[model samples]
Target: MSALARNRVGQYEVASDLSFGDLSAAVAAGWRDFRAAPLYGLFFAAIFAAAGIGLSYYFYNRGELAWLIAAAAGFPLLAPFAAAGLYEVSRRRLSGDSIGWGPVLGAVKAGDGQLPVMGVIAFVIFAFWVILAHTVFGVFLGQSGLGATPLQTLLTPAGLGMLGVGSAIGGIVALFLFAITVVSLPMLIDREVDFITAIIVSVRVVQLNTFLMLSWAVIIALLAFAAMAPAFVGLLVVLPLLGHATFHLYRRAVR
Candidate 1:
């Protein structure tokens, strides 16, 4: 809100020279936001968890439970969109605006319908990741055909190789998505910019603070994977935390 916080960039006001202190502050603010609206956080987290559980069940029933590995890796690709409501919660709290389901849920239309556009892009990336993951699985471990069990199959040498390659590819994909959406989603809710400009500004923020942003990305990936391990129940806490923190981070990183 101050002139000192503003860093001009080609007609856009952005922030630069971000440090670890900013990350810590953003996360602390995020925790405060979640604490202020526990029910909203819980509701959104539950929806995300249910979707994961359903996907796991679907794959298990189809005897392709091994794909859960790829699913877990690529799953976070969809998180930015899922965190849209959480962003609204944080935004309202930050501005002392009243928080309610109707306003928060309506955030999808906040930026002249850009949020839905981003959502479509998120789903498309996710679908591509899933299909690419299947190809990687086929190329690396299709011959073994899931072994006696999905767990046993993943423990094999071929399975390990597949994991390595798939993880590498997935990480690259996830990072790209992170770079683009890390600030864009919350920006969409906070401003009236089109998705393209939001994305460009998002990438500019990342370029300005590569190390800190990548560190944030790694933290997100680690926590998300850990959260997914216990039947995705941990997401009820982790997702909300990350989502709120992300909005706070966007606030700090962008003007």
Candidate 2:
């Protein structure tokens, strides 16, 4: 929690004149925070990484591409809460307080039902994406009976069209969810506000810093893609770093 941002009545005072340099600075500050509290970062990240790896192994060995796609679409929904621990770490460090796992865990658990509220939003958005993806898959490729000849089917016109349409639709869903939740997760953690207020504040911040926020969003997506390769091992580093960086961005962007 921010000391200067304390005593909230669920209303936010958004800041302006933020630039790309703030993003750069936030990354640097995030790195410093990570280095200072490497154990906390690693502990939280490892849990997420393990879950990702386990899911990948199960889906791959079972040849469940449909399940994989659905999981992929929904898995990112857990992302906001993955940083709850990191936010506590950053907030404690910011306050010159000594760090302890027990205290940090307590702080996260004591979120006053706000994190679960945000999680519901994340899951609902993800569920919508999965439903849309499945509908697209069924529309273009369902009657072809291409499940037996997957490699041959993707090159066909219908399959290719489905891919194009799904990509466009998925991109829009991702962008919308990103805008709504970009800073709201951290904001909820730091402020005494409802999810709606937090989400609105987050959207306003992104709207004010449109290009820079998009750049940061792209940065996050690229990192996420790279991390998913090699069995999600890279998330051990990337997720925590990005999560920590997001907390710093929240601090900078939210006054």
Which candidate number would show the highest TM-score if scored against the true structure?
A: 1
Q: lDDT per residue, candidate 1, 164-241, as tens digits?
A: 988888888898889999998999999878889889989989987899999999999899989989989999999999
lDDT of 1 at 108: 78
User: For candidate 1, what is the TM-score?
Assistant: 0.93
Instruction: List, residue by residue over 6-41, the lDDT tens digit for candidate 2.
Output: 323245666655788889888887888899988888
The models' CA-based lDDT, in order, is 0.87, 0.77
- Give candidate 2 misplaced runs (Cα > 4 Å): 1-11, 144-152
Q: What is the lDDT of residue 160 in candidate 2?
A: 89
- Candidate 2 overall lDDT versus native: 0.77
Task: Give each model a TM-score.
Answer: 0.93, 0.87
List the pairs of residues colliding in candidate 2. none
The predictions' CA RMSDs to the true structure, in order, are: 3.0, 4.4
